[model samples]
Target: MIADSGLVDGLRPSPNFGERRGHSRPEMLIMHYTGMADGESALRWMCMERSQVSSHYLIQEDGGVVQLVCEADRAWHAGAGDWRGRDDINSRSIGIEIVNPGHEHGYRAYPPAQVASVLALGLDIVGRHAIPPENVLGHSDVAPGRKQDPGELFPWADLAAAGLGHFVRPERLSGGRFFGRGDSGEPVAAFQSMLAAYGYGIDPTGDFDERTRAVTIAFQQHFRPCKVDGIADMSTITTLYRLLGALASSPLAAQGGSRGAIRTA
Candidate 1:
């Protein structure tokens, strides 16, 4: 099969894909890690039709890039997830799987070579499709409660530095008031609102439920990587505020871009 991106070094088509629904083009880029002992195992699983999971591209630790599914087709990567209240993520996004022994096995820092390849390939996809910075997200970001493939160790800030994703410098960790699970108040509700507004799958409920903690952990994994304890510490809340502020002032926000679904296969 022909590769959708020139950056692809090999074509290893996976049968676990289908025609996109609701849209013909992808509007988001979902990143994930293999979460297996090795890249080849991950590739084989994704290629098997029974596995029923595939990503458009997979980058190995040595920087090799394999194109498993054509960009125009919808890969069965994101299972059940929502973003900004939109539940059809697979229909509107391209998925990339990075090679790594994820949390369960033995999560580690991504090798420099792999990261370089990811940056190049990701930039190519983002530039060609014009994917919004905010739309470039980790699997955890889209499926907070059930998924966390590309975990806190993933270098989101590096991607932001390369102009591939949205990010803001996290506030310094210090002593101050914070919120956590079981907390119920208008402040918690407002915090939830900000998370929802930023496209996280969350309801603005006044009570900080377990779902809120999961969402908070996801947010911290992506933004405040220095710490991700599922508790909304002073640093986490301040970092969220700063990130929201940054997004509000971004050019995309000014144009009133919809956070729902994007189409750019």
Candidate 2:
């Protein structure tokens, strides 16, 4: 098959993709690690119809780019996930699978070559699609409860440095009034509000339930990478506050939170 994107170094089309639903314009970009020890194995699985999984592109560990599905088609990479109340993520976003073992089979830090390749691909995709900074996210951000590929060692800061995604140096962690799973009250509600406001599929329920913990873990995974104990600590809150502030001051918020006020992070 011909490569969909000229930037792609090669092509290995998968039959697991279909027409995109609802809006044809993609507004998000979801990233993931192959979660397999070998790049060849990951490629084989993605190409198999029975796997029912594919992405627009997959960058091998040695900086090789392979197109598994066309960008216009809805690749079945994001299954049973949500973002800003939209459950059909695969229909509205581009998915890029990076080569890594992930958290299951001896999760390890991504090598420099792989990261650089992904960074370039991300820049190209965002430029072509005009995807907003906030919409670029990891698979764990969408399916926190089920996935954690592209773990903390993925080097989000490097991506940010190259002007690929939204990120800030997390505030230092320190002892303070923290919130955990059992905590329930206005504070918890406020935290939930922030998370929802930041596009996570959660509501301000005033109770730190299981869903809340999951969202918190997701938040830490994306924002405050220093810790992911499922607890809202001082660093987490401060980092979130800074992120919201940046958004508020960005050109995207020209209408002054018309989408939704920056109530929380």
Candidate 3:
């Protein structure tokens, strides 16, 4: 198969992909970590038909990019997840597996070369597809509780600085009124609503349950990496608020509807 991006340094086609359903092109970009010992191992696993998993691209530690699945096909990455009330993420998103051992093994910081490669490839994909900034997300953001690849240590702020994903300066952490699992009230419901509005798959149940905690952790991992305890602390709340506020001027908002609007009061 032909590589979709000129940035690809190599191609190792995988048979674990199929036609994208319901959508003709990707609407979102999902980032992931291989969670293996090295890039070669990860690449081999993805190419193995028995693995049943593959991503559009994989970037090695030294910045080499390998295209495994064609962008026109749905890669078997993002399993069982929803974003913006929509399921079947594999059909609507392009996945990029960054090489890292992940939390299970080492979970070290990504190298500079690899990060630069990610930034370049991300910009290229988003630019060509016109994907909105808010649509660029981590695996945890879509499949919270079940996965956390490209974990908190991943350079999300760096990616934002390079004009890839949506991000804001996280509020300073401090002692304040916070909500956790077991809390149930209007406040909890309001917080859940805000998360849902920002494209996270959450229900405004008014009860801070396990699902709520998982989603909160996911948000903190991507936005407020300084702390990620699954508690809706003031820092987390403010960070989320600012992110939603910035959405007013985002391209998704200019699509002629109130797609990202949420009550900030």
> On residues 2-75, what C-alpha lDDT tens digit does candidate 2 reach at each position?
67566788888898999999867788999999988788898899999999999989999888999988888899
lDDT of the structure predicted as candidate 3:
0.90
| Model 3 TM-score on a 0 to 1 scale | 0.94
Each candidate's number of clashing pairs is 5, 0, 0
The order of the candidates by TM-score, greatest first, is: 3, 1, 2
Better model by lDDT, 1 or 2? 1
Per-residue lDDT of 91-210 in model 1, one digit per residue for the tens? 999999999989999999999999999899999998888888999999999999799879988888988998889999999898866778898776777677778878898887879999
For model 2, the superposed segments whose C-alpha errors exceed 4 Å read 248-265
Leading candidate by lDDT: 3
Q: What order do you get sorting by lDDT, best first?
A: 3, 1, 2
Clashing pairs in 2: none
TM-score, one value per model: 0.93, 0.92, 0.94
Assess each prediction's global lDDT (C-alpha) against the native.
Answer: 0.86, 0.82, 0.90
